[model samples]
Target: MAFKYSGSICSDLDKIRVFIDEILDKLNSIIKDQDTMFDLKLILNELVINGVFHGNECNNNKCVRLYLEVIDNIVRIEVEDEGKGIDYDISSYNSAELKCCGRGLIIVNGLSDEFYVKKNKVIAVKRIN
Candidate 1:
């Protein structure tokens, strides 16, 4: 069996965090490992917050879509937004000074087992049993 979790945030960071916490709570049965749970939570939070903050530039009226799917014991999360879209290319940034103002994506990249970005959507994935 599989499940899908999705929601839209009012361009508000707190609301977005709550939106994610709700999904994590629902998936608690499968995500019992604290470390795995923390990683998933933090990664999703950071990416979603980034999409809402930098991608959409904190436009409260604008909405961001978050989708989480469980398949083959892998929790795949895709956060989508209709903002200006990711303008920068992390690949071009210098390795020595690669950092963001809020350090949101940095935390996400560090925690996620695997993650990637396409346009304005950032995908975070984790495998759990």
Candidate 2:
């Protein structure tokens, strides 16, 4: 099955949290457990925040979209934004720390079974094992 969630909001950081929480809730219902949901939730939140704060440069006029898909026993999450893509080293981020926001994408890479990115977008995948 395929489910889609999207938001076009001001680039305000607060709005980023709200929209991500909203999308995470909708996807959690279809997932297997709380752990999975939480993982996906964290990854989703990070991507959304990155898209707004860093990618779009806090342009309130821009928006982002998140797409969820379940296929072949795997869950896929895609985040797309209206802003230009960011070029960061996903590998060199600090993995363990109280403040890991600097390595949000790296943390996401560790949590996801598979991760991919494209211009203006990112995708996180987890196999429901």
In angstroms, how far off is 117's CA in candidate 2?
2.3
Highest TM-score scorer? 1
lDDT (C-alpha) at residue 27 in model 1: 82
lDDT tens digits, residue span 94-123, model 2:
556555555777778889999887878889
Each prediction's Cα lDDT score?
0.76, 0.75
Q: Where does candidate 1 clash, by residue pair?
A: none
Give a tens-digit lDDT track for model 1, residues 1-129.
487887778788778777887888888776677888878877777777777777788899888888899876788889888776665454565547755653665566667667777878888777874
